[model samples]
Target: MNVPLRDPNIVMKLSRLGSFHQSKLSFLRSFLKEFKDWDYKRDLFELNEHGYGIAVYSFKKKNRVYSLICFANELDENERSDRVIATKWDAAFTLFDGVPAKQDIERLKNEVPKQEFGRLSFKELTLSRANKSVRIFNHVVESLSKGVQPDRELLDKVGYLYRTTAVYGSGKFGLADRFRIKDRKEIYGPFRLEMMLVYLVRQFTFDQVNHVAKNKNPKKAVKLDPEICRNLGIGNSTGLGMAPFIVNHPTLLNNWISARETSLKKIREIKNISNEEIELFLGCLKKSIKNITSWNTESEYQIKKIKSLLSDLNKFIMYLDKEFNFKQDFAFNEMYLDLEKNYCEECIEYVVSMMMEPFDDIVTPLIQEMSSEEGKYFNIPTERTVAELKAILENKYSEILNIDFSKKENNLNFWFISKNKEEPRLANRFDENGADLEQPLAIARDVKKLYDLLSVSKNSWTIAKFLSTNNELRHVVRRAFIVEKFPYSEIQDNTIGQEIMPIDMLRLKLSFFGALKFDPRSDKWLRICMFQGAPLPEQLKNYDEHWVYN
Candidate 1:
């Protein structure tokens, strides 16, 4: 049986994208899987009694090596701030292209802790800074120093000892330009180096806590149990800066959503399923429920989302247990159709991620396709006629063309880069002073503008001639052609809408990174946990690929 891919109009909605959960294709899981056989080592640990010093961790293969150099510093409680404006953090790190020398470490020691103000050579691939969860870190240290484990309930509530405020890569702050390392086969996967930095950082946190505890009481201190360390992951606080990523990298965005949709389409086409595959699917589905039930969020909006997801999942599980039969042909296809009719977007997308767990053959190739050579689509097809361009916009942007941008509410907000932090920020058009400085991120509004202008254009005129006069809308024209080839390339909603939830945009991007526990602090920023329930570095050689559900 052949099953068609889900329409982009339905699957590309911001609401559906925001509800996306991590699957086997997630970069974090793929990162671990790719480097599972690489040699792991901690070549240096020089922290003082308070865990304020330097450390180093690395993953080495036959010739290629990537090292994470860590710098732990003293941060007074009053000076530590997770907001981007902060100057100091508990620790800062850089993932070097290979192992570093004494001079290289000394050079970064003075600069890494300075973060943005610091200068990094091309050898540093990724840079990041994390602040300690002071309460949790101290509690763990105190408990371990007294020869006891910290309260498991408390540890699970706040999942990490440190939460990174930002992770920067791809040449930001003088790091190595991606062009320099883009050809490395092992690191071809998106954000592979960044994931390595964070995963190694997770290990650093455990080591630092143990170091501090042992220093406090040499006689009674004990190492944190490996099981408990496995439960903890690195947390992160992300802001509107991430919202523009999907808009800026449309091809990358398309590849991510495309991989997922392709997986679902292939899974639905299967004519038969073996008992082992069914058991693995059932096991992952049942265990993933814990991720939802244990989800902790104080935001009323997120609380509502979680409640509906849990509620719908209960109904779906009951249907499977009491009514559905796997013996039927094209069973998953039928189950998916039924889900769309009966479930919320959150529940439906959640199940879509779970459905891929039992099919490694379907997912492995898709992972390679997720990275994009975006420059291939940069040039617009200006030789096409206005009539062809008009039809493309009309078909591809059916919903966007209907939006009334003249409405005050439709033009209520603008996106701009902040002068202080040099990061993406969202602000009100009427209330904020930066409207004139607004970045060209409002693709929906601009696409509508293009469509309106193209309406009166002569159908016989070439797009190159049309652009000679309407050059101001050239960006959207380039995007329109890109979207013509890539269906999931453009977001079909108004990014400048008064009702826009910037968190929704952030959530969409983070979901692709395998982040969990989306606890929104506001409409502009949120906190999430990554690498939770993932295997430790030493165990990566022989670990369960299904650890995400565990």
Candidate 2:
């Protein structure tokens, strides 16, 4: 059965997009699914008893081997922090394109841990760092040294032994530009290397914990239980840094959300379902309750959401178990219809994620489509007329045009890069004084301004001619054209509005990264965990597909 995809305009709402959950289509999950059959190994492990030294892990298939070279350092308690402002971390990691020689390891050892200040060569595919989750790290070490596993309940609350502050890839800090490896079949999905880095980092955390425990009491220390090790995943501390990524990559954003919406529409169009498929869907939906129940967060906003989500989920499950029938045609569609009629946004989305759990054939094919050739759409379609451009904006940005940018609150914020680290940040336009150097993220206001200016221009003028004179508006003009073709490419709301939850923007991107337990420290930044219940590298070849639920 054929079904129409939702327009990008409606689907790209900050709220709708922000509500996204990790499904079979999420990049990390897809990465694991794609590379599961590849070779996995610890190519190098040269750490000292204290676990302060170098190590390298690799996954090779045929001629290609992506090596993760890890450098562990002894940092004083005061030196370790998860904040991006901090310079030192307990460990630093990079995914090298192939096997590194002695000279390559020596060169990288000097740079990877220093992070931003250190220069990386093109040989590097991705760079990242993780500070120890000191409380858990020390507790696990102490427990295991005494030959005991740490408490599962307490470990589940925080979920990781180390949370990386940032994972840099695609040309930032001299890492190889995406163009260098964009064509590789294995990594065609977005953020595959970053996923590989985080996944390997998860293994590193397990190794470090075991190594420290083994060292402390050679006679008594037993290895960490593989089951417990499987439950612990890498953590991430993200901030406004990730928010702009969605804004900047228009086509990529479109592809990610489109894959999701397409999957939903196809599921909705299904006319029949087998008993086993129905059973699998029901099983996953029931099992995923652990994800919601164990989801820990301190944000009152998120806590309230979790509470409401739990209440609604319970009701939906009750309806499914008691009143619903799988004999009905288009069973999932009917379930979805009932959900939308009865549940909250959180519940509807949660059910939507659970629906994909049973249809690996449908969702698996869509996973490969989540990545986009963003640069292919980067150039302006200069051959179009000013009249055509105006019509495009009028149709695509009808809601955005209603925003009165003259109000102080509507024009409240400006996005900029901090000079020290060159990281993205937002500030008050009137109070902070960097608005003049504002980044091109203020698309809603600028698109309106571009439209106002274009309304008076000759209808026959082409975009090439318009861009030649209106260079400042070039970015948004290019984006407007993108929004025309890729409906879900632009945020419908004014990002600079005083009421903007910048964390919402950050949450949207992090959700795509398969991050969970979003702990918003403030409106601007938050901590999250990645690969929290994912398979370790060694277990990748024969792993449970529903590890996230487990």
Model 1 lDDT per residue over 365-460, tens place: 998888999999999887899999999998999988889999999999999999998789888888879899999999999998999899999999
lDDT of 2 by residue, 1-550 (tens): 5667765655667766666677888778888998899999987888888889998999889999999999999999988777777899999999999999999999999999889999999999999998888999999999999988898888988888998888889999999999889889899888999999999988988898889899999988988788888788887777888889888988888788777888889988889888888888888888888888888888888888789888998898899889998888778778877887888877787788778887887887777777887777888888999999999999999988888899999999999999875679999988988788889899999988999889989999998898888998988988888888888788888899888888878877777788756777788888788887788777889999988876
Q: How accurate is candidate 1 locally (lDDT)?
A: 0.92
Model 2 Cα RMSD, 1 decimal: 1.8
Which number leads on lDDT?
1
- Cα miss at 149, model 2 (Å)? 1.5
Clashes of 2: 2
Off by over 4 Å in 1: none
Output the worst ten-in-a-row residue range by lDDT, candidate 1: 508-517
RMSD of each: 1.2, 1.8
